[model samples]
Target: MAQVLFLGGLGRSGTTLVERLLGELPGICALGEVVHLWQRDLRDDERCGCGSRFSGCTFWQRVGERAFGGWANVDVDRVHTLRDGVERTRHIPRLASAAQPAAQVREYASYYSRVYAAAAEVSGAKLVVDSSKHSALAHVLRAAGDIDLRVVHVVRDARGVAYSWTKRVARPETDGADEMTRYSPGRSALLWNAHNAAFGLLARRGVPVRRIRYEEFLADPRAAIIRLADFAGLAPRPEDLEFLRPGYADLRVGHSAAGNPMRFTVGRLPLRHDDAWMRALPPAQRRLVGAMCGPMLRAYGYPLNPQEAR
Candidate 1:
């Protein structure tokens, strides 16, 4: 009877921060981005936020050992290649089928059940955090049955997410060696629109869900954490906030040469907001974002256009 929490949203949203915060709660293990299903490989190139290679890192080693009965020796490059293939096709149904077993999908559900059990046992918590951010996976997990699951639909302003992606594209040398693609404002807005639409669809179908705004969480960390904890059936505690400070440095994973500047182990509760998107995006990009994501923006209580701000 393990509780499984699916934390999802479009990439570059505050899902990472939310994962870390949730990991601090009693008996919870936050597994960051275990999106690789067919390939179990972690290489020097793929840097997990935990400061370790996803495959060889001690943290994941223990997780694999506990969950899969042994470390399946993941290959970093192969997993990346498979991920690239999935992206190139833009076929979510195919990707979902790829994660399923031959005869029946029951085996797939069993695999996830074991994973959740192992994670909960190892973390000494009743819950596991799966931050894969794919709507298809969410659907598959729900259809698989027997897992008590809840979804946290995290959302951010489309312009803000686009601005962050711009920085990621620019800092390819620093962030990682991978040749990340730059997202046009139109594409970014569409991505946000699609992801939010998926979230809404699943939520309407009776999936237990809570929607959290990234900007609002930054504006009030304590209240936000408490609300999220409540939604996840967790009791709020002081240590959770203590572990959320910037630069506190405890969860480093791999043996990478360069440390993440954005990595803060602990510092102050509720980090400051980055409003650079308001100025960083050109007028044309801003309009594109607004125009593409207008419906979702309005659904989330954001202004549809700059003119509507006043």
Candidate 2:
């Protein structure tokens, strides 16, 4: 069975960077946010992690040929419709059943199984990393039983995530303002609690999960990656730890569908901690996120200071 290490968490929580670092390991091939492949990349023709457009990427071209006898044969709209309906918060729990396969789930899993298996074949890596950060998608993969799945739930401070969503970070591939995402503090915090809570439910339902806080990761990425490697059942080598250094990484293109513009990042990848929100974010907004997050922030070890909440 192909080994799939799925990253489940809220967006802008360092999931992309973690995937990039882990992708650099010897036995791991990181495929950025394949959950968005059909809708974003295939339909919209977004830029790939490498500098090429998704459809133009030669690596993904081969993958399409391998997985679905070329992308032309696949129905993108149907895939998305099924995804929105079945692979969602309300529909995922039903996937726990082994006897009766939900037709949509079965079909979706079949599509992804081919993708993951082909990634393994093409990349020659034993582990395929999918940093989709979608709990429902992760649950579908787990319940499908076609592959061996493990989860890494990446989290960051809700305040930081809120601040991040507020910024208009551009996609290097696009000169226009179409692809950017923005979220208010209240929405960011509420989703953060919901996503984490969903992953918690998944864990309780017997999915193997490993939680990693982004702050702790930045403090010592080497240790963090090693812990992750161990959880994925990979033997960590000394060189596998080298990519965590505070410098550029020799990144290559993968058949990733969508994610941060960091996919376009090559060469030096600065592994510094980002705490700009602590200073730049308005105090009121910080407090807003803190209040919306409520006990969840404390549960994640982020104490809501009265001063910050003010």
Q: Give the top-scoring candidate (TM-score).
A: 2
Predicted candidate 2 versus true structure: per-residue lDDT over 1-310, tens digit per residue: 7899999899999999889888888889888999988877778887888768878888888888888889888899888887887788666557544447677777887788888988888888999999999878887776566789889999898998999999988776564556578998888888898888888877877789998999888888888888999999998888666655554456655545678888767767777778888888899998888888868888878768834422
Global CA lDDT of candidate 2, please?
0.82
For model 1, residues 1-310, the per-residue Cα lDDT tens digits are 7798888788778887777667666667776555543342333334444544455456556666886667554334644543354332244444344544232344444555666776677667777877767765665566556688899999988888887777654322234445445677777777888777777776866689899999888777667778888888888667656555553324433211122233234433346777788877888888888888877888899886654532
Q: In angstroms, give how far residue 88 of model 1 lies from its true place.
A: 11
* Runs in model 1 lying further than 4 Å from the true structure: 37-48, 73-106, 169-175, 179-181, 244-270, 307-310
So what's the TM-score on candidate 2? 0.92
Evaluate model 1: give its TM-score: 0.78
Predictions: Cα RMSD each: 5.0, 2.4
